[model samples]
Target: MDTPPRVPGLGTFLDKNTGTPKPPTPQLVTVASRLLLLAAVVQVVASVIAVVYAASPARLDAIQLQIDAMTGSTPSLAMMRNLGILTVVISGIATITAYVLFALFLAKGRSWARVAAGVLALLTVMQLLGITLPEGLTTVAQIVLGAVAVGLCYLPGPNHFFATVKAARS
Candidate 1:
């Protein structure tokens, strides 16, 4: 048995080099992985767009006004601008990182990736109500693509594939 302090997605589960060839990944898993990757790409573009939009004078003023209304005080334009940009950029980076990791592991037939991807997709869809235009459209597309991708990983073929992967990993 392994030691107590093991990370999940290391050499054992991902790209395990058993002398035996792995069964070919199912088409559904392949599609799901690719779709997730595509969604990550779209998310990257949207994040960049958001960063630019968030930097706009009108946008910064709106943020300042909203904060002032809520708290009766407003931070300097530079501070608020930096925070606004940082907020979206940091969020985008974290999400893009997750998507890439999930996609890679999903391609490797990691069942947990499917579940995580599903959760991410669900959360993305849930935020649809608050999304704005331009970047919002891409966010919507990313959500749809992510949902479909995660859904594919749950289909019969991929279900069996993930099970087999689990067996091999053990």
Candidate 2:
């Protein structure tokens, strides 16, 4: 097959079959991919913190208080501790797993990953807002990181990457 001549200043050559120029991956996409991965790491750390907190004595006390208030009876400390640990471990692992998968897909230029990340970030922010005040520094930081990650996904570079990939696939 004969190679098409490169277009001046465009850096891409015209496809002889389609008569269209296929642009290369933009630098912005590369930056956005790295940011997405960083965001995933941040989320994983937050998840670990959550699990730790849930397994802590403070969390057990909170659960005990709730059970007492709801049932007019106090549960055994061991029971509350076991339940809290189980709940936290399972939910935290699942959340971290999902975030990692989303990050991987986003880095790979998948449009759906961006959408999922955006949705998750929005939900997290909304949930945080529902709280009367910032719970702690960690909570605040997690919210900020989540918001930043979502914003990065919507930025021109990442947005264009997702759009271009989708268009090419179609």
Largest lDDT belongs to which candidate?
1
**Which of the numbered candidates is closest to the native, going by highest TM-score?**
1
State the lDDT of candidate 1 residue by residue for 60-143, as single tens digits: 779777777765565777888898899999999999999999999898878888999999988888768877776689878988
Task: Give the clashing pairs for model 1.
Answer: none
Badly placed stretches (over 4 Å) of model 2 are: 1-25, 70-75, 127-135
Instruction: Please give the CA lDDT of all the candidate structures.
Output: 0.85, 0.63
Clashing pairs in 2: none
Question: How many residue pairs clash per model?
Answer: 0, 0
